[model samples]
Target: MSSTLQDLVNRAVFYSTEVQTHFGALIADAEWEVDFSSDPHLTFTPADGAVLRTRPHLLGSESDREKTWLWGWENVNDFPDAIVGLSHEVRKFGAAEEVSELTTPELSLDEELALRLTLAAKEATHKWAHYPAAAGAGTTVWLLVDAAEIALPAPQVKVSVRALMQGLTQTTVTDHRAAIESYVAKRGIPTAELPEGGLRMLFADGSADLSFDDQRRISNCDLNAPLEGEAAEQFAAAAESTGTPAEAATASRTSGSASAPAAEETAAPAVPTPSAPAPTPTDEPSRTEPQPVEEPAAEAIPVAEPKPDEPAAEAADASHEQKQPENEQPRADESVQPAEAATPAEEEPAEEAKPKKKGLFSKLFGR
Candidate 1:
């Protein structure tokens, strides 16, 4: 309805091997002739089936040849059979055992066209597109839909290559070929010309493969395994298998080298002990016990000189003063000096008194 083949294709139809092979041949070898003298209108209705109105070729009847052709929708019922027969006949041309035996019902025309368009677009765009060489070569078109852009198709329309690519890229579904044709119709492509009467590109060798209801365009090419889910698993297995012991050791060394310096930086500093240093002569006094200062005072005393005996007169007078006659010698000069010095036994009281006084002074003055 939006002017794209995707608008007409139904997702329910899957392209069988027979359909893909046949369609490829149709594009390669089919000869289509168009008349531009008068425009013809063709319509397909549920009630009438497929109808064609045109006199493009001569008919057996004069009236049939003279008037515009009209065919009913009922003719489409024979379409499957016609398409299958056409494929079988074309298969003989390819001569591949697999291609020649392909069936139609098993293939979806819309889906196959979509796949081709996708691959072609890649080629045209200078990108590589890959598809299974065979229709039944275990390949499937997987679509990742964006719900906001494209709605699911009804049971009527078949999926096509152009539809699949457009759906994937624009996140929408429509007949890509129809959209482009409609676009170009308003402003023609400089190098392309419309067919004599048909809505398709005309070329010397052949016409572009454009269908009226089931049109298509190409988007990309990818391996089949992604859709099958086998490629990823195989890659993972290969990666795991290739990791050897050498790699493990190298990884371990790398990890160790990274952390070694950081670990050393976090360790605490060591403390130095006093004895751990070398012993020097200046340090000897600090280790020795101190000497007392009082011992040196006693060793410094000088010898006392003895005095000569006093004169006889002085001695006689000192003796007479203590009631002895002046002419008598003083009793061993005792009158002039204390008698304790001449008598050792008398010296004991003086020595004892001196010590008692010193003891009393020491206690009071705390000397």
Candidate 2:
């Protein structure tokens, strides 16, 4: 496995800077004591209850070892424990967790490493590499997976996802129930059968999950939560907590935010394909709404001359003649004479037109 890392550490396991900071915060509300020296490795010997430990391991194949990010609890007598990972008995040793393994057949070494690194940064816990400053206080406990800027962990020989799935199936009654209850005994989470045929674990928090096919190949991973009750709130408060800006950023970089190239389309175009933007429901309605086009009003067009024989036309002509300035005569192409001027008047009188009816508005407003 190829890892993009900035440092290399020995076999000694430890909590990351962020995790220590968070663990520190987890105890800020009460009387607490911290142990920094490596007794059985770096530890958090909280006086009241659980002891947290940071453990690191080279997780990749014997042929190629890459850095990985990992952390776990130290001495907790009971932690609804189960390793939902390919084979490990427990990954969320602290509490509220999950582990994903991609088969070499399903994902390449690089791809798996890429995915692991991505997840670790945001969700996974790394060994101690930073100093601790207890940032958590009040009733809430905030924990981080990295604080000392620990180097990433080595990628391991990941076990089969199907094996984990098989162990989690309902038929394996005890294991299946344990798989979920182990965490749910803490809090209720989500699990669903994918449309493409796979399994997923979900939480109310904005987390990521993998979607695989029947063959247990990851098809896609989506990065995508509610809460209730006093008892529920108390339970959540006790389950597990983490939030440290530095460690959050480190965890983000190592796991959930690891950068890797996406799979290119088999027949990708050299030039980008022009995609028509899909109209949203809101956009569609707005598109159908009438939008008036701006244009000059009809008054700008010259009015057509009326028929010559109509009495209204004759009357209009007479009115025009009256309205014209005496100085401005008709254009001379040698002006044509009127019937009266030519032969001393012999014109038929035309019928008068009826008046138009008043409109509704005109009648109502007396306009």
Winner by TM-score: 2
Q: Write the per-residue lDDT of candidate 2 for residues 1-367, one digit (tens) a residue.
A: 3212111110000112112212223322122121222221223333454544532221111001212212212111111112112112223321233223311111223312321222232223322222111111100001122223233221110111111221121011122223332322222233444455534443333222345433333344443311234323432443344333322322232333224222111110011101111222222110001111122121211112221221110000000011123342222111111111011122345565444322111110101
Global fold similarity of model 1 (TM-score): 0.14
**Candidate 1: Cα lDDT at 61:** 8
Clashes of each: 39, 41
Put down candidate 1 lDDT per residue, 1-367, tens digits, no spaces: 1212233222211111112211111112111111212231111112223222211110000011122111111112122232122222322322332321121112222313433322222212211111111001111111110111111111111112222221222113244444444323321211122233223322111122232332343222221211113333332333355553322311231111222111111111110100111222233111101111111111112211122221000000000011113342122111111111010122355546532111110100001
- Residue 84's lDDT in candidate 1: 21
Question: How many collisions between residues are there in candidate 2?
Answer: 41
Q: Which ranges of candidate 1 are over 4 A from the true structure?
A: 1-43, 46-83, 96-367
